[model samples]
Target: MTIEQVWAQYRQSLKAFLHTKVASPNDVDDLLQDVLLKTHLAIENLHKPTSVKAWLFQIAHNTVIDYYRKNGIHSNAQQEITWYNEAERNIKKELAQCIKPFIQQLPEQSAYLLEVIELEGKSQKQLADEMGLSYSTLKSQVQKARKELHGVFNACCQYDIDKHGNLIEYHQQATKGKCSPNHMDCTPGVRKKSDDKYAHCSKG
Candidate 1:
């Protein structure tokens, strides 16, 4: 598919396909980006015109599985938007109260770390270099900052309740060591959540 053709051909179909698999509109949007990127890359290597729809659908399937693999449908990606909306609906006043004072309570470095890393999406190494600190020290600071913010958010959970008025469970189920579908091995790269964080933790 050409650029124009790709958009025209796959946009709605991909959106609908992802909507069936995911839980929220936010997830739909994320998967849409994934499918389109895959489609654009595969468009160049098109060998069979008749199989375009199948090819695109296969990409969509693989993208959804990849999302489940990495983020595991249990991480921030799912509840990230849901929690934001839930806060907006049930507790705007409590949200402001907790966040404003918590920001003020953070140390200058902690505040800057949260802003740059959580809010602005800077990596730990980038923030460390910018602040003239060692990367290890910067990451340690970020972990501390995240722990503190998690505390504040947990405190505000006092106001967060379901229709039955019970506390909603919002913990992320950390991805397990096992990989699935094909490559399940004891080897380094074959494990699930086999990112650098695991290596660092294991060494420490």
Candidate 2:
């Protein structure tokens, strides 16, 4: 997307998110603008950014940190800021919003399995034991379910993958604007994701 489009879509949201971290209106504006410029410049340099919303917020996040650092704020005081915690929640919220639609579109078995494994946090080993299958067999079944979920996702949006089978970028189908990035950390289970936003839904 062009810088203008991104700015129009996200400028106010960025400001609101920044306000939760930075108090001054002027500073928030400055940080938001900095986020725009940084995003514009770094878009090409960074590993291909799949989620523009997440990418912009992360820049805003670092801008907040840099703002604190430049002001010579004590590390202890900086640690008190809670934007990152909120940011993490927002991303996971987006994940929940975006993934379920695709999941529901899957075949019933695939959909149910994904719900149990990824959404319901069921233990694959225990599930396998209950079904009289080995752990490896359950893992394979879960993997196959995730693969079907990935297929449903791709049917809605085109994705670009890097050499190592990592998700690099994506373009959403215009009709599917409600679909947000999965942010699955390349693992579609109930496992917690690290801050690696770009690698979700990899072929690996």
Candidate 3:
């Protein structure tokens, strides 16, 4: 399909599909932008008009799966964040504002660990392997990092936690199963490990 036709026909469905999969509305916008940009560049390779929805969704699904593969979700929590008005956004943004100071105050190793494992979403095993550290060391680093992050949160923000002690905004999902970067990672129950037969670009 032509690039323009692809964008015109599939953008909204692609966004909705992503909205369901992605927890944050802002993140959904980011992912949709990435998908459409990639689709625009690779549209020439898509040959079937009738399959556009499936095709775009495949792209959307893979993009989000890759994010999880890299960043891991926040806390293994599945509940969605609710923001009904600008006031809510301001509150969440205010809560998130502590993030900067939290990162800056972290010791170098702790900061690096958080960036790699938390921000980048690599599995503990994957990160430990890459850093050439033993699993035990990596675990220690993660604990240290989380502890310091908590301290930063506590010191900087009154809204970081509720009286019940659960974090206010931490959200995460357990990956359904392992996926190789060399292959496609499907949704937990719906897909099994398979090669990326549909990816249009080699670099993705």
The top-ranked prediction according to lDDT is 2
Candidate 2: tens digits of C-alpha lDDT, residues 3-52: 44566577777777778777798888667655643443344333444566
Better of 2 and 3 by TM-score: 2
Candidates ranked, most accurate by TM-score first = 2, 3, 1
Over 56-135, each residue of candidate 1 has an lDDT whose tens digit, in order, gives 66656656654564332433333332212221221222222223344444677777787666444456766777889987
The C-alpha stretches of model 2 lying farther than 4 A from their native spots are: 1-94, 161-204
Residue 168 error for model 3, in Å? 39
Q: Which regions of candidate 1 are displaced past 4 Å?
A: 73-204
What lDDT, from 0 to 1, does candidate 2 have?
Answer: 0.54
TM per prediction: 0.36, 0.40, 0.39
Candidate 3: tens digits of C-alpha lDDT, residues 1-204? 444445555666677767777789877876775565445334434455665565556556556765565454543212232221222112212222223334556788888887666545468878888889987888887877877866643342222224432223221113222222332221111111243222222222
Ten consecutive residues with minimal summed lDDT in candidate 3? Answer: 184-193
- Runs in model 3 lying further than 4 Å from the true structure: 74-128, 132-204
